[model samples]
Target: MCSLCGVLGGRGHWTDTSSHPEAFTHVEQPTRRRERQERTRLVNTVLDHYGLSLSDWAGSSYVLKTKTGQTALVENLTELWANAEQLTKHDFDPLDEALIDSLAAKAAR
Candidate 1:
């Protein structure tokens, strides 16, 4: 039994509560592998519209090459997805308008 939650040895015992005073005791952090998978999924979905794909560049970085042979350095999948969302809202070339609209609409959902 624990003092804070009155539960047995489970989730609460894993975190160092002293470091995150404001964080809830039961709040769970996403694992690195899970985050990577999610990022890959989002990046793939966004890039697939343009017939592009994400390839690992260096550790923790990715490269998205467009059909026109232009390359975009995605520091991380989150950043890549965000840039796509922002650019699609405007008139971004190289990306088909229909695809942009479709991806943007999907993101909204």
Candidate 2:
């Protein structure tokens, strides 16, 4: 028997469906891709409203610059949005509050 057959007890590693119950199942990559795209789109929509945008730095992190000239290194969309909402709440701007509410509602969905 070949090396693969010997290791799999005479069954082909990729061709044998009897030994591995999940040999043909492919069900996670595309869902994750769509989720990532959607998250990025929603986050960008909110950021663009405030004249802010995410700049890719390295890995899964980004740099966000606020309209007030403040900068933050946000880990992800959720963290960045949350921080923005909190930081802007000190001044009590109605438009900002409404925008944050809209972002929160969309994120919850």
Candidate 3:
């Protein structure tokens, strides 16, 4: 629905009651938004050319650049199982999708 009619039709990519069935919340953190766009582009480029998901190397983590142009990694530092949450579906390789699924699982616990 989303890939075809929703997003393609400019109806909505997040909400349409076809899947979510709820009013979606839109949070526009500029930093996060820019990072997300960059990550998405990186993932698509990598996947298209390399046929590999970044998660394979990242162990399902994301990296960030700080205001001072420094680098930081936001990860589950709890020392839990590398995949304890059973997050991320088997075939969902796109960075944004996998991250969302992974985060959802972590939050549920």
Go through the candidates in order and give each one's C-alpha lDDT: 0.57, 0.56, 0.36
What tens-digit string does per-residue lDDT give for candidate 1 at 10-56? 43222324334467454676654555566667767767765667776
For candidate 2, write residues 6-39 as lDDT tens digits. Answer: 3323333342232354664755433533544565
Deviation (Å) of 88 in candidate 2: 3.4
Ten residues in a row with the worst lDDT in model 1?
A: 10-19
Q: TM-score for each prediction?
A: 0.43, 0.43, 0.21
Off by over 4 Å in 1: 1-27, 77-109
Candidate order, lDDT descending: 1, 2, 3
What's the C-alpha lDDT at position 34 in model 3? 54
Candidate 3 structure quality by residue, lDDT tens digits, 1-109? 2211223233322412232434534463334345445654554443333232322224334443322343333332221112222222124333666666655665577
For candidate 2, which ten residues in a row score worst on lDDT? 1-10
Local error of candidate 3 at residue 58 (angstroms):
21
Which candidate, 2 or 3, has the higher lDDT? Answer: 2
* Model 1 score (lDDT): 0.57
Instruction: Tell me the lDDT of model 1 at 42.
Output: 74
